[model samples]
Target: KFPGVPRVERVSFNKGPLELVRHTHMASLGDAAHFEVDYVDMPAGFNDPDLSLEGGISGLTHALEAQGARVLTKEKVVRGSCEGRDTTLFLPHPPRKEGFVEGRAFGSGQRYYFLMFVGEEDGPQLREMARTFMESFAVTDGCTAQPAPTPAPSSPTVVSVVEGTHDAATGWRKIENTELGFGVLMPGAARHESEQAQVEPFPITHHTYINEDDAGVYAAEVFGEYPPNFHNTPGSYETMLDVTLYAMKRNFEPSGFTITPLRDLKAGTFPGREFTVTNEKLGAQGRTQIYVTAKYIYVFTAFTRGQAAASAANALERFFSSVRITTK
Candidate 1:
C-alpha cells in the first residue's frame, strides 16, 4: 500500500521470467517511503543449494554493494517466527536514500522478500515503521500454521514408503489402479472396495479404500466417470469439487456441522481443494483433500474422534502428496 500516494498503479504480466505482478508505488520525488513484497521460485538446480536464507542474504548484500550502496548492518534474526536476516543499506546517489531488507526462505526453493526504502535512515519515525512492518510479516492462508496440540500428535510425521521399497519404517504402501491410471500411497494395511452405480450417463462407479486404527480413520474415494456435462462445463472442475464439499458439509445427520475451508492445493500439477469437516451427528472430525484428473476424481480423508486430532494432520498431508494422477 502506498501511503497517501494517490496514484498507485498495478501491472501483471505472465510472459516474462521475472515476477508476474508488480506495484509501482514509489514516488520519483525521492521521499523514501517504499514497501514492496515479492516472491521468487528458484528452481532446484539454479545456483542452489545456495538458495536458502543465508545464501539469499549474502547475495542481496553483494547486489546492493554493486549499486554504490554501503551495507550499514546485517544480522540474523527471527522475525515473525521465521528465520530471516535484517540489513540496513545506505545509498549515496543524487537522491540519497537508506532502506531495510528482510528476506525469508520457504521450502522447495521459494523465497519471500520484503523491502522498505526511505529517504533517511536517521528518522526515528521511518525506522520504527520499517521495523514494525518487517516484524509483523506473516504467512497466512495457504501457509498459516495451526498451533501444535498440547500433548503433540502421536504420529506427527508419517515417513511412508511406496510398496516394494526395502524400508519397513515406510508405514504406507502404494495402491494403483492401472486401468484407472492413478496410484496412491495408503497406510500399509488399507483394503479396497468398489461398486458400480446404475445411474444416468453410464459407466458410473464408486471406489473406496479404507482402514481404521484404534485412534483414527483413513480413506480415499474415487468417483469414476461422473456426468460428462459436469466436467465439460466451464469451471466445472472447481464447481463439481465444491458440490462434493457441499454434500459433505450438509450431511451431519441430526445436527448442523461446522466447516473450515483450508487452503487450496495441487496434486502434482492437478488442481485440488482441502478442507476440514465436523460431522456433529457422529462426533467425528476429519481433514479431506480432493483432486481430479479428467475422468477420475480422488478424495482422500483422514479423521478421528474429535475436533482437534493432531495425529491425523501429518497423515492427511502425506495422503494428499501421495496422489499420482495420469489421466487428462
Candidate 2:
C-alpha cells in the first residue's frame, strides 16, 4: 500500500505470463487527492541496455505527444544505479477549484504511472506525496509463466436519438448549422444551445451541440473569444494559445481523466491542438480537438463508453471527417 494514502485497494491484471497491479484510493479529500499507481510490464524486446533511462522516457514522451498530450516538465531522479524518469503532464480539462498532476516513473526494470491531484494552492504537498510514493515503490518478479487466456467479447447497450430519414447503408444524416459556422455528418438530431461563460478576463459566448444515445455522446463547443487575450501579434497569439489550452486542461481535472500529450493538429485550414482522455471511474473515453481562429476557439469532443466506445468506430470516423469550419 502507498504511504499517506489511506484505504488503498489493490487490483491486478494478467497479460500472458506477466501480472500488473493497480492501486487505487477512490475517496480522498483536502490536501490529499485521488491517487492511483499502475504497474505495467515492459513489452518483449524492450530490454535494451543501450536504451538509457532518459532515452526510454523520451520515447514515452514522444508517444504521448503523438497521441495529443503536452508534457509540462521532465526530470531524472537517481535511486542508486536504478535511474528513474519523472514527468508532469497537463490534463485536457481541469476542474475549476483544483489542478491535476500525473507523476510517472520508469526504472529498475519496472514501469509505473502515478496519478494525484492538488488544489491550486497545494503544489508543495502534491510533490511530497509523489516523492513518498516513489520512494516506497518496489519491483517484484512474480508471474505465472503461461500464456494468458483470450477474454470474451462484451455486449454493449447503446441508445441513439435520430430524427429524419437515415440512409439504409450508412445509418446517418448530414447536419449543417450555419449559426455555429460549421457542418458535420451526424447519426442523430443535434441539439444546440448558447451560454455565456467567463474565460478569464472576458465573458465569452459558448455554443454547444449535444447528440447522445445508448451508443455514446458527441459534443462540439464553439467558443467565442476563446483566447480573451489575443492581440493579433504572432507572439501574443502564441501566448493566448497557451492560456486557452491551460483553461481547457483545468476543465477536465475534476473527472480525474488521463490525457494523451497534445500534438499538432489541423482543422481544415486552421492549425490547432488535439488529444484524447480516458476516465476509468466514469467508464468513458473522449477525443478532443481545439482550434482557434481570428475571433473564436472551437472545441470538438466525442465521448463513449463500454461496448459503444468500441463499436461506434465507423460513425465516429465519418463525423469527424465531415467537420467543416466555415468561420474565418
Candidate 3:
C-alpha cells in the first residue's frame, strides 16, 4: 500500500501509462482512468477452500452485468487460480460507451479484485493494462488485511467493573461506557480509570483499561468538540495525524522510536486511522486508532511492554476487534 492510504501502485507497468486505483466507488477513482482495484483483508481463521478464487471473479462480473454491462470473454488466468473477464458497458442517457476488463486473485491469505475500462475502441489496450497491473500487483509481507467489522448486537448489556480475578468461565468480559458511548472486551480483571482534560477548546474524557499482571493497557479518549481547524480534507489529514504523532513522541520520549504510516481504518461503523508505534529501547509497542465523528473524536489505544507483550498479542487483537461504538 502507499503508506497511509489504502492505495497500491507500480512505477512502470505498461506503455499506455497504466495506473492502478483501488477504492469502493468509481467516482472515487478521480483521474485514475487506467484501472480500479478493490482489496479486502480477511480476518484470521478465514481459511475456507470452498470460497474459490474463481467465485470472486465471477461475483465481480455479475455485479458489472447488473450495472448494464455485457460480458464478451471470461476465462481463468494462471496466477494462484486467478480469473479475468471482459465486458462492455454503456453510460446512462445518451449511451456513451466503454469497455472493462476485471481480474481477481487470492493467494498468501489475501484477496484482490481489479477493474479497468476505456473507450470501446481501446478494448485491446484496456485488457493489456489490466493484465500488466495484476501481474505486478502484490501485498507486502507482514502487512495483513483488516477484516470487515462484525455488526454489534442491539441493546448490549453494560458489564460492571469487578475487582479480583476475572471469571475465566466467561472468557473475556465486555465493559461499556455509556458516557463515552463505546465498549470493549477486556482480557480479564482490568482496572478502569477516567478523567477530563482539555484538547484545545474541547473537553476530552479519557478512559483506560489496564491488566497489571499481563502488562497490557487499553485506552480510549473522547473529545466533545474537535478543533475545526483540524478538519481532514484531502491532504490535511496527514497534518492532523502529524500533530497527534508529535505529541505522542514527545510524551513517550523513547530512546528508539518507529511509527507506521497512518492508514484509513474503521472502528465498528466509524471511519478512522490506524497506526503502530514501537519503542525498542523501552521494549514497548502500541497500536492506536483515531476516529473523527460528526459530534466527537474518539481515540483508542493498546500497548504492552517486555516479555509479557509477546503473550498479550492475542488478547490485544481480541480487545481491538471487540470494540464497538455504542453511540450514534
Question: How do the residues 1-328 of candidate 3 rate in per-residue lDDT, one tens digit apiece?
Answer: 2112334544322211222233332322343233445555433323432232434445555555656666666554444334333333432223544545454544444444444443343356655654565566554552233343333334332333544334355477666667667766666555666554432223344455555444656665555544443332332333334345545565655557676656787645545788886767767687877765544566677777774655757756876787677645
Instruction: Show model 2 residue runs off by greater than 4 Å.
Output: 1-169, 198-203, 225-229, 235-238, 308-310
> Considering TM-score, which of the candidate structures 1 and 2 is the better prediction for this target?
2
- Superposition error at 104 for model 3 (Å): 44
- The 10-residue segment with the lowest total lDDT in model 3: 11-20
TM values, all candidates: 0.43, 0.46, 0.41
Every candidate's lDDT: 0.56, 0.56, 0.51
- Which tens-of-lDDT digit does each residue in 123-214 have in candidate 2? 66766765665576544542222223222234332333334346465677655666557766667777767665432233456777778776
**Model 3 segments beyond 4 Å from truth?**
1-170, 199-202, 225-242, 255-257, 268-270, 308-310
lDDT of 2 at 10: 74
Q: Report per-prediction Cα RMSD to one decimal.
A: 17.3, 19.1, 17.8
Superposed model 1: Cα runs more than 4 Å off: 1-169, 226-230, 252-257, 279-285, 306-310
**Residue range with the least summed lDDT across 10 consecutive positions in model 1:** 42-51
Clash statistics: count for each candidate: 2, 24, 0
* Candidate 1 Cα RMSD (Å): 17.3
